[model samples]
Target: MTRHVSTRRAATAAGTAIVAAALIGAGLTTASAAPTAEKTPGASPTKLSASQRAELLRDADAEKARTAKELGLSSAEKLVVRDVVKDRDGSVHTRYERTYDGLPVLGGDLVVHETKSRRTEGVTKAHAGDLKVDTARAKAAPKGARAVVWAASGTPRLAYEKVVKSTKKDGTPSRLHVVTDARSGKKIFQWDDIRTGAGHTQYSGDVELGTKQESSGFSLTDTGRGDHKTYDLGGGTSGQGTLVAGDDDEWGDGTPANKETAAADAHYGAALTWDYYKNVHGRDGIKGDGVGAYSRVHYGNNYVNAFWDDSCFCMTYGDGEGNAKPLTSIDVAAHEMTHGVTSHTAGLIYSGESGGLNEATSDIFGSAVEFSANNKEDVGDYLIGEKIDIRGDGTPLRYMDKPSKDGKSKDSWYRGIGQIDVHYSSGVANHFFYLLSEGSGAKEINGVKYDSPTADGKPVTGIGRDKAEKIWFKALTTYMTSNTDYAKARTATLDAAKDLYGADSAEYKGVDAAWAGVNVKAAKGKNKH
Candidate 1:
């Protein structure tokens, strides 16, 4: 069953922040670079100078000592501290370290690098990207066991953090994982497991138990910093929000060896995506009605990608092998969740033009979510999949202005282009949405700069977001059905604009102009694929 707990300060102000992307095309060209985030989506990225680094390093070490004491750590444990990234969004963070309290009461050691967002302190991630808290309680001795956790660069502060579970000499972590809100210091999600018997011993061999060595410097997404990976992090939260449960769909095993790292990576992305929708669009859940979707990490056998299953209302991600990594980034999560939202509201057909529209809608909202979160670890940009890189070129998977840049999408929406994989075909709609929301010529909105353009030589105009979203939602739910085609989508959306935004509202004009910018029209000409 789902649980809904309120701590404090819940408001609807998000309605004002997040709107659909339908900016009018600027009619300009993109820059040579694939678009630098300028900032991570959550907190601002703070690069420390040599002198500053020394100071931060000192403070980090001291902080570790204080935290160890607070957690009742012993002297045999040695802890290492690092600064939590300060994203461009100016969020509150609680950075921790990986250390042991002398030797374990049992025969091992306790070390962790757990960081979390300080929501009670109002430490929100600007990019709406989630904050990852890395904590561990592994072995410290040379032969007994040792677990190493590398600090991910872009983590935000954790709030209302408490140890929900721990393993006694019995060897079971009956309970593990804690959950809290970023805006208010409330215990929205928590669990406490008491181990009763010896845990699985074979896991030690598969996980390099006593021989575990420290590995570092794995960037999660794009940005020169932020986005890290963990071999072991055990702990989880409710819903797909934090899938550390070691299910068939999960990518990693949430054991004492690796629970914290996995939880940090998965939950950071999920929470950030959640906040993006809630704070920006006033959406309650995937359907704007307060439903939480499950996010399963460590999916399948060495799976290499992440996917949103509309049928299951869940997202599954892999650990990536043979050069393939999990696509579970903030934008990626947003892309997947938006699918659920679209399925619920628009039910756009998954084939042909409507399919492309549906797919693009996911990309559109995903990017917007990144922008809304505005973190320093992961900034909002018009690029996709720059984090996982499935490609080794150190570039993103797709570009908004020129979908063809990815060598997969049609620059313009041709009538019959829907046969392609929805991932690729989504380019047409992605470009159109960007143009609609961030209308033409370069300028800064929410501290991020975006420049868009029209298909033809003409300059386009945009309808404001509030009206645009209402119109889009109306079109999807009221007029269109599962089999709706692109042509039908156009008609339905226009009709929707007229009904709610007024036949002459700029929103109405925008729907027309947006379609016009994409070369989508009523006629059955060459514009027809």
Candidate 2:
């Protein structure tokens, strides 16, 4: 079975598949960059403001021709800037998508880093060399496939990339990207882009919501965070439902019986996620563009899932079993929104090792967002989907402290891990983050007892969650690429640590130790753990 989002398998369940098929018949398609480290490192990194980011983007675009020439690319090859990040020291990291002869080049994304003095430091690329494949050799793409250059993992070749949009059995939308060999028509790689999470009627208690005061009543629109709005999907599986509104500022009674209760949860979750990114990480919004992504609650009847669809750029939550349990939990909301952030920045392709990293990134930030909220009703814990009771067993969907506790996720990295479902494969990074933030060994946090074990039987000393999350955020935004794997992730974090806290700092050592705890060791002679 394929993995869609979060912890569940992707194959629609027995009766669920029929629902999914019916949703498909009605068009239920939904779904869902560079890590780099400083080379000519300077001062402590500070995130760029919205205007600065926009200006840098413009500058990057103006220099595209120069960049192409410096990289010695052919005339047929062109570069389009996807994102640009400026460090506190004036160094710039620019991410770009590539096209060859006016054709999209899959796996052709790359990042170029420039020192403060404007000297090119280095280039991180998904495809290492120039495109040599002949477009003439490309055959017709199957049905919905689009011709392109497959350069994500292996050798650059002519390929067709197709996005299959469908609904999963659990009402989890699937935006599956399937790449096939253009000549042979053989499947090369595939990944589901739809990422999931959820909210109250269960998680957060009575909480304040950001709403717009309309003449008639109050609308579930938060003007403070890019005018983010929440809507009620009613029981339909397609299209955005009506914007949730009320006659007064007050909303929800802390129960699923009140439809506005779910909307309040969803809205509150979006606000928390927005504030967490803006306040802690300096990210203005999911795209760092100050434009908020809306949310949809009460998706399908007993849908049993919540997901983020990049196509609509919105969060969708379902009414879990019997419509009594809404999948609108704080952590789940944060988790799903982080997928949007990942899409805008690292652009991690949703498959294999990269896909695992993609999911782990969301989980990591989801936990961080929860802890940041510090709500009395739902104290922070290193557990995912705990409030939603996704499995009906009163256990979380995943445990970061020890991922294997759930029985499906792997706690450590191993060979062929890329072949497993991404949700399970994400365990390695999740464990690493936990060990990095809280260290290895038995301990209790927020009334939750955890006994984290190391794969190598080595004790890992933590540098605290604050420093840990900072290192991760830097690594993800600066060093990571769509094709980065486990080893690459380790290096990226290490590099991020060196940039943030110095190479000799304990935080850097902690990162190394944490990676080691997950059995992803640094290369020979570079092992500091």
Candidate 3:
């Protein structure tokens, strides 16, 4: 039997404020520079100005000690600050990566929230409880011992085999993660890490790109973000081809007459998406670590798809028909890059309701990025892949207003929704987002006409895209987890709105109404934190 492929197939598989303004300001800095080094135990790294750096170090140390004590961390385990943000009100949110016996602990990360007074408020951990198991006993096979692969759960893990299973129908070997209890050799966790990810000059019209100045002329590398480069695949399916470099910076004309034209479009799309995240959410690049992911274009002849692969931390794009048109439009580029963002954060599982949310997250942000660009040619809208002509006819891949227009997506949520494909199930969240940002009834945004309705027949009042995007982003980063279902999504967005706005604010209520509009009910008695 021929196996089915997800609409979001991978060639492989695969935010906060300062005083509010400061966090946004920090994100606006696009210059490519090495991020602060990960501070080791008892070793302080400088941040901010002299005075502020000292103060931050002191506060960070105290918080780390508090976290270690609260979590009952052993001497071998240490908490290292990855990033820190301070609100204008004095509240501080510090993200940390845990290390076990000087070795990095995959999935062992957490966030520490502290009051302006330097008191520990709470912690959001990726994994629960202390790791009391011995690492020495967790040995791996000689050949399949350890490999870094992308897991559907979000971030990559150091997977080792406790047992190797029989090969699957796909002719791929199955190496189950060895999650045995450190003390009793009992299994603790297990998952398969495989997933797959871009760019341009010819396809995207006339556009400006940020490239790095190299001895071999200027290369298609963005120095402003994380050295993100766009390469020409030379029509081949695999391997990173040559970089689109030249002495003159001007990339392409409108048509794919020149191979560089498609590359120019792909390159420009990546830059815009990077700017969107940085300017809107204060996120610096996909991983939020100031590292730019690379993009590969022209994969195979008439490849028809694009993807974000975490294994290589890059994006890949394919030509549409006869290798003439490439799927490297602004929205499509942003859509692929947003996949990288989802993988690093909430990591909603790649199957079931969570998987739908994962795909919707990309679509939602991809649309937002297009709107942010305000490009006259693309013209931001609620439609996805409208420019790509993926369907041969002029119809877009998916419609945010009425997802069922494609005949496979669900405009609203219902029980057992997880049984459907992720691309189809994602319609529920996409519809919810549209209703929340644009409201119900007939309307036109950026010249695109849309008539959105609620499953409950109760009209919803939109809170504007600006607020809606922030709320969804906050929920994804701070609240939603790998297994968060649709119901949990409702609660998470509500909590996110409460955090950004007040608990009783209009935006908070708008989130609740929006969820109800999608037929996703809020959990009973779930109060805002």
Candidate 2, residue 89: CA error in Å? 1.9
RMSD (Cα, Å) for all candidates, in order, is 21.7, 10.8, 12.0
Query: Candidate 1 vs candidate 3: which has greater lDDT?
Result: 3
Q: Rate the local accuracy (lDDT) of all candidates.
A: 0.45, 0.78, 0.67
Candidate 3 whole-model C-alpha lDDT, 0 to 1: 0.67
- In model 1, state the lDDT of residue 514: 73
Question: Which candidate would rank higher by TM-score, 1 or 2?
Answer: 2
Show model 1 residue runs off by greater than 4 Å.
1-259, 278-282, 287-289, 321-325, 441-453, 463-471, 523-529
* lDDT (Cα, 0-100) at 83 in candidate 1: 29
What's the TM-score of each model vs. the native? Answer: 0.49, 0.89, 0.75
Q: Pick the candidate with the highest TM-score.
A: 2
lDDT of 2: 0.78
Displacement of residue 53 (Cα, Å) in model 3 is: 11
Where is the poorest 10-residue window by lDDT in model 3?
Answer: 18-27
